[model samples]
Target chain A: MAFLARIYVTPRADVLDPQGNAVAHGLHSLGFGEVTEVRIGRYLEVRIGGSDRAAATEQVTAMCERLLANTVVEDFRFELDALASDR
Target chain B: MAFLARIYVTPRADVLDPQGNAVAHGLHSLGFGEVTEVRIGRYLEVRIGGSDRAAATEQVTAMCERLLANTVVEDFRFELDALASDR
Candidate 1:
């Protein structure tokens, strides 16, 4: 099996996003009148191989906890792609 | 127009990824001998509306520069989703 894993990391809700704030100010200057809030995050695309779906899932979940995510300030979640699916 | 933006924020190649390293060690502990390396990042999905494609693209790009991305340590890129496309 192969997988493309996307992880989302953000400051906790109570934490302010200075980058997002700066961008919001920039948007104000750029004439995007309808925009209100902006938040920033990250994405990762991973390819993993395994003999079976169960094995792949196990491997990926472990991968996330140990390497892909920081449990302190961020939360992690992912979805599996069908073996032959196109990106 | 609507967009699903996936931002990939990774340490520069010169920078070491401790979280990724820790996960690699964990995988080694879990008996998955085939694993080699791990890297982590974040993802974001956004929805935008504009009267025209050009306007939408302009707004989205501005959004990325002004709010959605941290240019200092991270690189940002995004793709547009057809307004009616399914997630």
Candidate 2:
């Protein structure tokens, strides 16, 4: 089976996110006073071929732990769906 | 009222994403041979104070148009929700 995974990697809430802070400042300067805070993260789409959903999920999780996210300061999660073209 | 927006900015399908390619290579090296393709994008959380849902939605749209995305090469979308602690 083939699957597509949508993965999100976000900084742990307690971590200081300098990039988010910078974007918040930029939004403020642009007159978005209503904008109070900003948090930035990475979104990834991974396509994988595996024997089944469980195996695909395992592969995606490993991908996150090993390559996509720095687990020390970030948390990662993903959703896997069977691809329409899997046939 | 306070609202939280989850925004996604992704490269257009036609654009070449070098970063995505680099990650695919890394995944292949890590022995995830079943990994076929990868695309990377940005995920953002924007906290806003607005008068109403309509206004908040407008603000989020403007933010994407003006700063959050390069519309010519990227596409952006968002989900807005009423914050529970708006009081």
Q: For every model in order, what is the number of clashing pairs?
A: 7, 0
For residues B1-87, write the lDDT of model 1, one tens digit per residue. 344444455555565667767756776787656555556554554455454667667767776667655666556666655555342
TM-score of chain B of each: 0.67, 0.94
User: Per-residue CA lDDT of candidate 1, range A22-71, in tens?
Assistant: 75566677766655555565554455555466776777777667766576
Q: Over 4 Å off in model 2, which ranges?
A: none
Quantify all predictions' global Cα lDDT against the true fold.
0.59, 0.91
True contacts kept of each: 0.30, 0.86
Clashing pairs in 1: A23-B66, A23-B67, A42-B42, A42-B43, A43-B42, A43-B43, A66-B23
TM-score of chain A, predicted model 2, versus the true chain A, to 2 decimals: 0.94
Q: Top model by DockQ, which number?
A: 2
Candidate 1's displacement at residue B25, Å, is: 9.7
lDDT of 2 by residue, A1-87 (tens): 689899999999999899999999998899999888899999999988865998888888998999899999999999998987644
State which docking tier applies to candidate 1: acceptable
